[model samples]
Target chain A: MICMNELQLTVDIYALVITTLTLVNAGAVYMIFYEMFKRFYGAKLKFETPVKNMMTLCGMEVTDEVKHLVPVSEIMVFTFRKAFKHITESLTSEFESKVLRDWFFYALIILTALIVLSLIMGWY
Target chain B: MTDLNLGIVLVSEVLIYPGLMFLVATIIFTQWLWRKIAARLGFRRGPMKTGPAGVLQPMADLLKLLSKEEVRTALSSKRLPALIAPLGIGALSTVLLTTPLAPLPIWSPFDSLVVLYLILWATVSIVILALSTPNPYTNIGVGRYLAFIVAAEPPFFISVLVPIILASRYYSDVNYSIYKTSLYSSSLWGLNPLTATLMLLSAFSGFISMMAVMNIKPFDAAEAETEIYWGIFTEFGGPRLALGMFISFAERVVLPLIYTFLFLGGSSPFTFTDNYLASLITTLIKFFVIFSILAIIDTLMPRFRPDQAVRFLIKYALTTAVIALIASITLTFIY
Candidate 1:
C-alpha cells in the first residue's frame, strides 16, 4: 500500500464514480423491473401472489388458474415446488423484480472493491 | 486555524456541533415538535411519557425498532448495501457544516453547488433503499416518489441558488458559499425594491418546493399511507423501518434548516461572530418556525394527486424561481 497523499483527488473521483453509478443503475433497474413486473403479473394475476412470496404465503390455497402452478396441500411441498417453479419460470427469478437480485450483487462487488481501495489508501 | 486545529475543528464540525450528533438531536426534537403540533391541531395530546412532554418518544421508538429483526428477503435488498441508508444520513449531516450555524463554518468558492448535490445524495439514497425491495404497492409508491422528485428538486435547487446569486451580487462576497450567502440573506430583504420582490417570490417558491420534496402534505402523495401502502417504505420492517423513518425525519430537519439560512435569515439580530450561542439559538428558532408553518399547512391541506402536484410545481414553483433568478441576476448587475 502506497503512503502517498497525492492520490486524494483520485480517491474523490473514485467515490463520485461509485455513488453516481449506484444511483443511476438503481433507478434504471427499478423502473425497468417495475414495468416487467406489471406486465408479467398482468390483469388476471394482478391480485395473485407470485412464487417469491412462497414462504410468506405458505399453506394458502394456490390459484388454480395460473399456468404451471403445482397446486399442493402440504406446506413444505408447496414451498419447495413453488421455489423450483420460480427459478424455471423466468430469466431473472425476480426475487423482488427481475434483475434486482443481480443488481444487488453487482452493486456489492463494486462497493467491496471501493471499500478495499479506501482501506488501502488509509481513508478511514 | 493551524493545520492541526483546523483538523480538529473540521472533525468536530462533522461529528459533533453541526454534524451527526446535532442531526440526531434535531431529529428527536423536531419529531416531538411535529407530533405535538399535529396533536394539538387535532385536539389530542401527543406523546407525554418516556420523557418530559414525550421528548424522548422518538428515541424510544427508534430503540424498539433497533431491537426487532431486520427481516431478510429472498433478495439482498437490505443486506447488500446496508450502508446506503446510513450514508443518506451522513450526507445530510455533512451539509450542516456549510451553514453559519457551525461554530467554524466552512466555505469554498461555489460550495452551494456542493450543498445542493449533498442534499440530493440523501434523496437518492432513499430511492436506492426503496428500489431494493419489490412489491406492487411499493412500485407505484416509488413511481409517485420519483415523479414528485423530478418535478420538485430543480425548483428547490434554483430557489436555494437564488439567494447565493443575490448575495454574491449585493454583498460582493468573497466566494460562492452558502454561509456567506446566508449571512447576507438576512439583510438582503428590503434592501431595494428589486431585491425585496426577488426575495418574496423566491421564498414562496422555495417553501412550496421544500414541502413537496419533503413529502409534506398536499404534496405527500408519495408517502401518504392513505394513497399507497407506505409509499417507498412498503417493504421495510424492523431496523430497516427505523432507518427509513430516520431518513424521513432527518430530511424534515435539513431542508428547513437550510431554508432558514438561505431564505428566512440564518440567525438575524445575532451575528455568529458577535455571539455564536445566540446566533445558533436564533437559527434553531427560525428553523422550527418554518417547520411549524409547514406542519400547520400539512394539517390543513388535502393530498394532491402526483400529477396535480407536478403540474402545480412546474407552473408555480418553477415559474417563480425563474422570475427570482432573472430578478436577482438583473439586480446583481444594477447594484
Candidate 2:
C-alpha cells in the first residue's frame, strides 16, 4: 500500500510529463505548418494558356488557392484551409509516406507509455 | 534535514558552481577539439603552435568571440525576445543539475525525470525563440531543427526507459528511492544471451541516436553549412554567437555525459579511493572518449540529406530501441 504523499507525487509527475509532451508535440506541429508555408512561398507554379474565345478561364487554374494562402483577407478562413491542408497531408503522409508516418506514430505511442510508466513507477 | 534548508544550500553550491563550470569547460574542450579534428582531417596542423598542441586554443577563441562587435540588423524585430534565446539555453543546461552528477544521495531530486523533460523543452523553446528572430536562414534552420527534434525525441526517451525498467525490476526494495536504483551489472535479463544482446544493442543505439540529436556529425542537417549558411547561425554574430556556440558545446558534452552516467556503467569503471575526485575524473574521461569518437565520425562521414537521415533513424536505429524494450519486458516475467 502506497502512502498519500507517494501517490500524490506520482500523479504530479504524470501531469508534468503529459503536459511537457503535449507542448513539445504542439511545437512540432507548428514547425510542420511553418515549413509548409515557407516551401509554398518559394514553390513554382505551372499554368496552361487559355484561348480568348473561351468564355471560361479554362486551364488558367486561377483559383484563390493558386495564390499564397497565408495572406488571405479573412484570417480565420485562411487558417481553417491551411489547417485542413496540413491535416490531410500529415494523415495521408502525402508529404512523405504513410508507412513511415504510421511507424512514427507507433514510436510516439511507445514513448508515451514509457513516460506514463516512469511517472507511475517513479523511475526518476 | 529540513527541505527548505537542503534546497537552498543545494541550489547554490551544488547547482550553480559545478553546473556553470562544467558548461564553461565543455565549451572550451569542444571548440579546441573541433579545430584540431578539422585540421587533422584536412591534413594541416591546427593550433599546435599556440600552446602545447594548442591546448590554450579554446581560451584564444573565447577572447576572439568576446572582442567581436555585437551586431543586430537595424531593420530586425527589435521588440523580439533576444535575451530569451541564450538565457533559455543556459537554463536548460541548469536542469542537468537535477541529474545525479555523482552517485551522491543529496544530488538526486524527487522529480528528476520531470527535470529532464523540462530541460529538453527549454532547449526547444530556445530553438523557437532563435527562429522567431526574423532572419530567413534562421527560420529555415529552426524548421529543420524542429523536425529533427520531433523525429529523434520519441526514440531517445523510449530507449532510456529500457535500462530503467530492466534495472527497476531487480530492485530489492519496493520502497527504493528512485535515485538509488541501479542498472549496473544487475542483469535485468540475468545472463540470457539473446535478451542481453537486445538490451545492449538498444542502450548503444539509443546513445548514438542521442549523439546525433545533439548534432555531433553526419546527422547534422539542421546546421549543414553547404545546405544553409551555417544553418540557423547565419545571422548571429558577436556575443550572441558566442552564447549559441557555448550552448552547443555544453549540450554536446553534457548530454553525452548524462547518457554515459545512465547507460555506460556509471561509476563502476573506476574504484575511487577518493570518491569525489574519482567520480569526477571518471566522468571527464568518459565524456572525452565519447566526444572523440563523435569527432572522428564527423571527420570520416558525409552528412546525410534531411529526408534520408530521418528515414534511416526511424527504420534502423529505432528498431534497436524497440528490441531493447521488448527484451526487458520478456525478462521481467522470466526473472
Candidate 3:
C-alpha cells in the first residue's frame, strides 16, 4: 500500500510533467506558425547586405543608381514577393513528394495524441 | 572571522579558484590543445616552436595582439559598445563560477535560468559590437547569427528543460524548491530504458545546438572566412581581437563544463566518496571527454551554409527535443 505522501509526490510529478509538455508543444506550434507567416508575409524585411556596406565604407564609391531610375522600395517589394512565391511553391512540392516529411508529420501527430491521452487519463 | 571577512572570502573564491583566473587559464590551455590536435590530424606540425609543443602559442599570440597599436576605422561608430564587447567574455567566464565545476556550487535560486540569460547576454553583446562598426560583412554576419539563434534557441531551451523536469521529480523536501535542486544530481540519471534513451537524445540535441552557440565548425557560418572575410569580427584588431579570441576559447571550455554538469552526471560519478576533490576530478574528466569529442568534430567537419545550418537545427534538433519532452512526461508517471 502506498502512503499518502508517496501518492502526493507522484501526483505532483505528474502535474509538473504534463504542464511542461503542454507548454513545449504550444511553443513549438507557435514557432512553426510564425516561421511560415514570416516567410510569406514579411516582405521588405531583409537583413542589410554586409559585403556591399563594407565596400562603401572603404570609399570604393558604390551607388544603387538603379534605385534612382526606379523606386527602390517598389523594386525590393517586387523581388521579395517573387522570392516568397518561389519558396512557397518549392516547399509545397517537397512536402507532397517527400516520404521523410510525411513520416515526420505523422510522428508529430502520434506524439501529440499520446500527450493528450496522458493528460486526460491523469497518468499519476 | 566576522561577516565582512566571510564576504571577502566568498568574493575571492569567485575571483580566484574555479573562477575567472582559473577559467581563463584553462581556456588558453584548451585552445592550445585543440590547435595541436587539429594540426596533427591534418598531418602538420602546429605551433612546435612556441613554448613546448605550442602550449604557449595562445599566450604568445595574446601578448602580441596586446602590444600592437589599436586601429579604428572611419566607418566604425559608437565607440562604447565596441570597447565593452570584450567584457562580455569576462561576463561569460563568471557563469562558470556558479556551475558545478566549482569546488562549491554557487547556490542560488534559479541559477540555471541565470546561466541561460548570461549566455544570451554575451552573444547579443557580440552582435551589438559587430553592428557598431557599420561594416557590410559584419552586418551579414550579424544577420546569420540572428537566424542561427532563432533556430537553435528553441531546441536548446526545450532540451535543457528535460533535465530540469527530471530533477524536479525527486524534489521532496520543502526547503528544496524546484529551482534550488541541482540539475547535476545523480538522481536525474540511471532511469528506466525509455526515459534514459529520451534523455540521451535530448542531450545530443542540446549538444548540437550548443556547438552553434559556441560557434564551432560546420555551424560557424557567421564567421566563414572564405566568404565574408571573418564576418562579424572583420573590423576588430589588436587587443580587441585578442579579447574576442579569449572569449571564444573561454566559451569552448565553459559550455562543455555545463554540458557535463547537466547531462553527464557531473561529479556524481565520484559521489560514493566523501572527498570533494574526487568529485571535482571526476567532473573535470567528464568535461575533458566532452571537449575532446567537440574538438574532433570541429577538426573533421566543413562549415555549413547559413541557411542549411538553420534548417538542420530546426528539422533535426527540434524533432529530438519534442521526443525527449514526451518521453520525459511518460517517465514521470512510471516513476
Candidate 4:
C-alpha cells in the first residue's frame, strides 16, 4: 500500500490535475464548435446580391440604411458557395492535420497511463 | 456520571441490541420529519391523524409501501445492478453502524478511516447501480446523478480530511484513538483557534454538500418529482421502492452521525450521565437537528436545474471548503 502521507498528497494532486484536464477538454470542444458555427453563419450572411451591390456601389462606404434593408436571398448562390467553402476549409484545416490529431491522441494516452499508474500505486 | 464515563457506557450500549433499535427509530423519525417539514413549508399540518404530532404516520406509510402492488415497467432494464441498487443502498445503511450517536461508539474494532471509506464506497456503488437502469427518463435522472456526484464528491473527500488531519497533527499518539477524546480537551493542532474554526467550517460545508449530493431536497436533481417521475426512481415500486426509501432514510441517519462524530466530539455528550439512555437521547437529538434542517430545506426551497445546482455548489459549498482548508493550514503554522 502507498504510504498514508504519500497517498494523501497523490489524491490532492490527482484532484487538481483532473480538474485542469476537464477544463481543457471543455475549452477545446467549445472553441472547435464555436469556430465552425461562426464561419458557417458569417458566410451565409454575406450571400445577398444587394449586399454585394451595396458593397460595390458604395465601394468603400455603404450607407447603414441600404445594408439593413438588403435581403440576404439575393446573394443566395454566392453566399451558399462561400458558406460551403468556409465549412470545407474549416473542417479540413482544423481537423485534417495529422499533427494535431496525433497530439490529442498522445495526450489522451498519456493521461490514461498516468491515472492507471496512480490508481495501481494507490490501490496496493 | 462524568462525561468520559458516560461515553464508555454509550459505546457499550451501541454494541448491544439498542443500537439496532436506534437505527429503526432513525428511519421512522426521518420519515416523520420529512412529512412534517414538507407540510409546514406548504402551510399545512401533515398526517396528523396518525398519532400525536403525526408520529404514527411513518408506520402507516411504511405499511402502505410494503403492501403496495409491485409495478415493474415493461421496458425496464433486466440486470443485476437494477436488482441490486436498492439492496446496495440498504447495505449502506448498515455502514452507518460505525457512526457514534450522542458521543457513543456504535461498535467495536472501529476504524474511522474504514468507516468513512465504506460510507463513500457504498453510496457511490448504490448510485452507479441506480443509474444503470435504462429508461430514457431514468437515463436523464442518472445524468443528473452523475453531474451531482461529480460536483459534490470532491468537496466531501476534502472535508473528510480535515478531522483526520487534525487528529493526526494534534494528538501526539497516532493510531486514530483521538475519537475517544473530547474535542474541548483534545490538543487539536495544539489548540490553535484558526484550526478549530476551519475544522468546524469544513465539517459544516462537508455536511451540507453530502446532504445535497445524497439527493436531499433542493439539491435533488436526480430525484426531482415532476420532471421525471421521481427521477432515477421512475421504475422502483412496491417492496423494492420501500427498501430504497428505507436505505435513503438510513443514509440520512448515518450522515449526521458521521458528521457529529467527526466534528461534534463523538459519543462523549450522552456519556455524561445514565450513559446508555443519555447517549441514546443525544444521538436522537443530534440526528433530529440534522434531519430537521434538511427536511426544512427540502420543503422550502425549489429544486434547482442540474446545471444551476452545480454552479450554486461551486460557489457556496466549494468556496467554503477552500476557505476552511486555507484556514486550517495557516493555523497549523502560525498558532
Best by TM-score: 3
Query: For residues A67-97, what per-residue lDDT tens digits would candidate 2 score against the true structure?
Result: 2212212422333344345556666756456
- Sort by lDDT, best first: what order? 1, 3, 2, 4
> Of the candidates shown, which would achieve the greatest lDDT relative to the real structure?
1
Ranking of all candidate structures by their DockQ, best first: 3, 2, 1, 4
- Judge candidate 3 at residue B226 and give its lDDT: 83
TM-score of chain B of each: 0.96, 0.84, 0.91, 0.80
Which lDDT tens digits does candidate 3 get at residues B227-317?
8778778777655565566666777887788777778777775652366678788888888888888888999999987766776777668
lDDT by residue (A1-124, candidate 3, tens digit) is 1222111123344334323322332233223322233344433244444353333334434543211122323433443354345546658776466534577667656655654564456442
RMSD of each: 17.6, 13.2, 12.4, 21.3
Q: Against the true chain A, what TM-score does chain A of candidate 1 give? A: 0.28
Q: lDDT tens digits, residues B1-335, model 1?
A: 36576556656666677777778788888888888999999999999998998999988987666555445345435353355776677777777766777766655657677778878987887888876765444556666777778778988998998888878875664355776788788887866555666677788889999998899989887777865658778667656677778778889999999999888888888888788789888988998889899889998899986666776787678777876776556555552
Q: Weakest 10 consecutive residues, lDDT, candidate 3 chain A?
A: A1-10
**Residue range B1-335, candidate 2, lDDT tens digits:** 46465445434432344445456656676778877887898998888756777878887765555445444443334324334444445454454443445222222223435545655754565575555444444555666666566556767766766666655556654222223332243343344444355456666667667856777666787688876667657666544565566556667766676666556655555532246567667767776787787788888889876655565666556766876677567655653
What overall lDDT, based on C-alpha atoms, would model 3 receive against the true structure? 0.61
lDDT string for model 4 (B1-335, tens) is 56466435534343222343456566776788788878877888887888788888887776565555434433334444434543344334434433433233232222444445545654665555454443444555666776667667777766766665556445543333223322322244235444555565577679768877678767787777777667666656544455556556667777666666566654444453346566666656765777788788777778876666675566556666765665445434432
Top DockQ model: 3
Query: A11 in model 3: Cα distance from truth in Å?
Result: 26
Output the better candidate (1/4) by DockQ. 1
Error of 2 at B133 (Å): 1.8
Q: How would the candidate models be sorted by TM-score, starting from the highest? A: 3, 1, 2, 4
